[model samples]
Target: MVSLICTLQDHRDDVNWCVFSAKLLATCSADKTVRVYYTKDFSELPFSPLSGHGYPVHCCSFSPCGQYLASCSTDATTVVWQMDSGEIEAVLEHPGRSPVRVCAFSPDSVHLVSGASDGTLALWDFTSRSILRTGGVADTTMVACSFSPCGQLFVSGSMYGDLRVWNLELKQLYAEKSAHDLGVTCCQFAPQMQKGTGGNVVQFRMASCGQDSLLKVWNISYTPHAGCKMQLLHTLTGQTAPVLSCSFSADGQMLVSGSVDKTVTVYEASQGTLLYTLSQHERYVTACAFSPMAPLIATGSMDKSVNVWRVEDGCSTHEGKFLPGEEAASSCEGGKMGGHSRLMPSDWSEDDVSSWLRQEGLEALVDVFKANNIDGSELLALNKDALATDMKVESMGLRSKIIRKIEELKMESMCTGVPDEYLCPITRELMKDPVIAAGECWWSTSGFHDCAYEEGT
Candidate 1:
């Protein structure tokens, strides 16, 4: 895999989260400082440090437009910062009862949702700088909160393993689900115009991981059923230890999960099949993420290092394969060497469009609807026809073939162009200008890491 971008260390202790914003990388640490580094020059000095958290920060994130930074700490406080000036714009001290676990900005950047230990969820308005509403408790400490993609509804998960859906406009609980036997780790709304599943249905899903060792997926459709609060559609449970964190890829087609077991697993979100297992870290994998704009994966660990892995055509069985940087272009081929089965035939299904979409679109566009919701039937009908002879299917088949050939070419270049001495242990990531530790071990680096250094040494 190609490691196009690398992480640089500026924190002395564990790094909680690193956000890329407007050409600067801002990271929070257990050392209670926020350091901003330049992405282009990893060796350059960092901007001034911003410190105010009384305890280790749990998470830090940037706004959608990259204008502001928000962070939550174990010290019962959440701070908002001006990214350009590195100045604290607002400090929200929660009521004496709870320490904030997580905080997120709305899509418009006018509101913020926070989850705390007191079993309460709070919504604040940026303009008014006041709490607009406090979502009542179900006696479970809320660990994570997220707004639906449409911003019409919001949901929160708790330490008691409960999940609640709220009508944000009405400020009332609309639905609830007992998602896990333990606490829910995170929740996210699918982005708009996202293809794969739940297309334009105003639907959302929640991933709950606790002591259960499984990641449960729920289907929260807008159409509320009297008895169906939330649909438990799929459960991904191969982790040997508790799944501490889970995140969806930009397209929502893939899910990356980290666990106390020291392994990060990548799965097909729609199919729930384990696609890849990142086996580089020697300690508990605490953080993992997909680059929003690229196919690369970045993971951090208690091992005090960060490693970057890219999504290439190479199969899991071919983890250590690599081509020298100098040989990449001269022997260039598409990247699909033995990656997956040849793409299915275009006419394999016969229909190009999904039945659900056709039905939903016709119904939505047509004024006269049905009595029993014929829109669903219309969607099914459309899907059946589209699947029958969609040209895209044929294109997909061709793409698959091309991808496989590319992989073969990459492998060929690596085998022929690269010298034996230049080959590092193929770590499923490219190390541009790699510097192995004294012992000849490669590591994830932004700063000095003893364990990784020892391995290299």
Candidate 2:
């Protein structure tokens, strides 16, 4: 029942990475541009694209507070932008002209750690807009870096599969270990947890994945004499192909990973129990992340698609429960009861087609139908097979008509800009057909109606 909430097709080439904040999602692509979209309404176009990178952008990260975004490209530079205005705040150029492989923000949101191709890790202090410290140089390039949730430590992974831990406060390397047989692709400090000691003290842990097809969790502890100690806790092995990315859920109780095998797996964080294996993507899964403030996981793939999945009670959603005959009719070829397939039935009734479309959450297509002067109720009443024939016969002319109508509507709306007060506080987007409760704020009618209904407002 892990239904796809939506698929974003804005990127023209392979999507390398995607990151989510409280309200926005930032996706960087081989198209040499970064597109930021509202999480609530994927149908809306990006406010503007970030386009200064001369080469394919490798990675993008948001500040802890979601006020800024940092992206590194093969152009040997990193650009930081104001999230609200999309204005470049700083452009960090590597003196050696080596591409930055990855970048991360400190838990305090004041410092940025970047790993570069020259085997160097640089810590930049945003307040000064300059490099504060640089260390952890290896013969091979650096691949990944992550700041611990406690803000006391940071970790970096090298192309040689070595993992290095550094004390953020002291700005010095604290520990180092050979982590993987092959190059380490991703490393992340798990969300803070209180592992009860015999007394009342608590310890922390971290996780890393590599091209060796292994995921390792490490126990982190502090000692007066040794300063910091990291011990191998668990080794997770299920993926047959190289593991590319991993993420810890908001509660730190679960972990998810994507790999070159075209699958996403969810795991129990502590004992590494496999929970669910989602095999929806058609190509190598490149990136995966858990939302900080919601029970959602977003994954991007080499297939040029982004999928959002709900992570709760075996990935079931309220809207996914099927009625009689609905399951078989909507099931794609080769799709299991809980899986998704691209092949859909062609001889479906209009109601079946509409329900299938709604289940797939194709908001853009729904918008197109609304803009084309087609009656929503009537469209839902027409036979899908007939509609398919009409579409094939008049494809180009129908597309042109829909485009013109959409453009006309956009111009009309532009002439009457939305009132500032009616915008959603979280997304800062205009509320369409807003509905308000007694003392609560107004929300868009289509997207957030579930929240309001759940609250019994």
Candidate 3:
């Protein structure tokens, strides 16, 4: 499902961030410069290597219209670049002059947010290039900020592992402290919006990766009368080391992450499932993004290289086909993806579990399961030892069959669209059934992807 297209070795230092617009791709580096490339052919822009910052650039983003690009740096400033000419449009200084670690443009492109190392956040009016509101948590570095689709709210993540929701005025509306252990590195809101339960509340989905080596998906629901609530949806453990960055595809169906493990991971955003763990980077994969113009991905690394990859239908690796930015952007409309319910199988009730057993022809155990009050969550925790010792199941054949089915269900919650890789949360992992690693231990171990595939499989 993922294949390397090319490796771009332009930056001399660590590639800190990478992003894409409709027709162009932009990358910033610790080398104190930003590079621009045409998506069609990966060619550099005429006025590229946009050198405006006095120090390393930490983040980069393109405006919705692709007319301007923004990059923030350790220089304690956020610079706006006129994309066509790569000219510096304005330099907005952070309120405290603390090194800005992250910046993001609002979905409407009218507002921008820059978070600093001093735990300060400045909201800017992009049109006037002026600061509008200043607020933040004390004593904690602000490392991440993302605006909800409605543009009425944005979320900020601190180095202390706290996730806070702020309104346009920069007032904290909600907070989830210790959202991640150790620290929170990045957070991004899905582009698409969803209506809340009963259709009155406005709901937003966000994905955050942290120093805890876990990537989590959360549902932030806001009701006009009730204010806001944050709920955890999934905790994805696909990376071996700290996850450095995470991004959602334009359609919000696919999610990709780069990690200190030197791997690029792709997932089904809706299900928190792992699709593929791409091990091509020689060093830590620090940045990753999906192109708004095509089913393509660009990953940047501490190895000082940027790798482009193509994601397509099925488990087979192939080159990516192109889609115009407009067409790709249009996919965000309706904000709904068919197939699969939002409530994952792990949330099934005891009755639901019994029904599923009947469907899978484990009817003989349905009464026993009902007596034990097994639910979807408990069902997923079942294992060979538990089945034999705890449940007293004597039939090895029945245990194996039940275990196989459980493995498949476990992967069904990892992501919306899972890839075909073994033990990957995608591709339904029809083959993992105790196959273990290929070329040697196929007779046992390793079977099923954890919840990550929801594409055209």
Candidate 4:
């Protein structure tokens, strides 16, 4: 993981989902292609691009047995493909819907379950290529759904603040809980559960996040006569904004959460204790996962970057760290106290820049080249070479105009590199929220213990 063993850049846009099967890693992109990459980098083309989706691909998963592949698209269908041939073995279509948002293969590989934006859950018979049952929850876009590790149950959390625990075998609702006050963005079942110190037979636990700006954990216990008793055991507050994604570590000791607040927090499972916050992302952290084989945590963000961090290494802080010759470091002598000037942009102010806007002047020429969408780097080189000739007011005016034009161009370029669907819903320079950094140990927001009840009433 340290070396970035390989790079797969086939997708013309964002790669939203990536799933692994023993030796194969498959990625689904907004470019409407599912690419399969071998773990052992092939000297030849390492990725086989599987394309056919009529719309952007949203999610992809490999079967538990690692023999089959599944993907969901904005095209209103879920596809199951044969890994070796890039052939579609089954297509599960949902009518009266915008698109399927999530799809997963059960542990036994007998069933494929998909949840869509229309608030419908479709159970598919994987072997027969037929829809088993289609059920409706409140009509809200479903963001994420997962099959319980045991394959005995399935859970769907909606953007409408409803979390449904469904008995897959029984094909009925076991428990419906309002876990979030607003849309439930992400939810995950605990990897393991056991009877507690008080003899409370906890079968499983789940964590959910949403618009309420809090993470809620439920204690799920099965009773002989009452079906399942779901209790809200703990409400953890740290994220300052809605949590967009959450995942439980394989060992069940740690839980990881990514939020629109632009940070990732890892928590202790049993006691609902906050463990660490990983917040290196400069933009909204979209998805997070704990490695099934190691203590590594991976996070994807709107910063157009993916980061991997150590589980033991807590949240990344942007606070200043000592480094040599960095200008902003403490070691710098006499650079001016309270140095705000250093932070100003090079072209902070301009006056009489009209002369620089002409077609014949170097700055004017660059402006013309830019407006014509000519070679940008070539124009940049011409401007740099011309800058060495004079320090006249006319030259300065031209420079200012060129600078302004460049700024305008950059602003327009934002979010243009990726398809509109792949752009994260929350992305405006995401940073670690103050609350998430404090974890469960303290309410850093209010500067006290048990702060939510004190101030939030």
The prediction achieving the highest TM-score against the true structure is 3
> Candidate 2 has which clashing residue pairs, if any?
none
Candidate 2's error at 163, in angstroms?
Answer: 0.9
What are the per-residue Cα lDDT tens digits for candidate 3 across 1-457?
Answer: 7889888999999999999987889999999999999888999999989999999999998876577889999999999998878889899999878999999987667688999999999999887778898999899999888888667789999889999998887878899998999999989998756654543456789999999999999999875445789999999999999999998887678889999999989998788888899999999999998876578899999999999998865221111345434433311112221112223555678877876675344777887788778887688778988888888888999899899778646533222332334433223333333323433323222232323233444
**What is the number of residue pairs that collide in model 4?**
3
Best by lDDT: 3
Local distance difference test, each candidate:
0.55, 0.67, 0.79, 0.59
lDDT of 2: 0.67
Cα lDDT tens digits, model 2, 46-132, are: 455789899988889987656778999889888998877899989987657788889888755657878889887777876566887
Which order, best to worst by TM-score? 3, 2, 1, 4
Better of 1 and 3 by lDDT: 3
Task: Please give, for residues 87-165, the per-residue lDDT of candidate 1 as tens digits.
Answer: 8988877665577777776644556777788877777775455777776575667676666554556777777776777
How high is each candidate's TM-score?
Answer: 0.62, 0.66, 0.70, 0.61
Candidate 1 residue-wise lDDT at 270:
74
Better of 3 and 4 by lDDT: 3
- Return the clash pairs for model 4, or none: 238-436, 277-315, 356-398
Flag regions of model 4 displaced more than 4 Å: 1-15, 37-45, 169-177, 193-202, 310-457
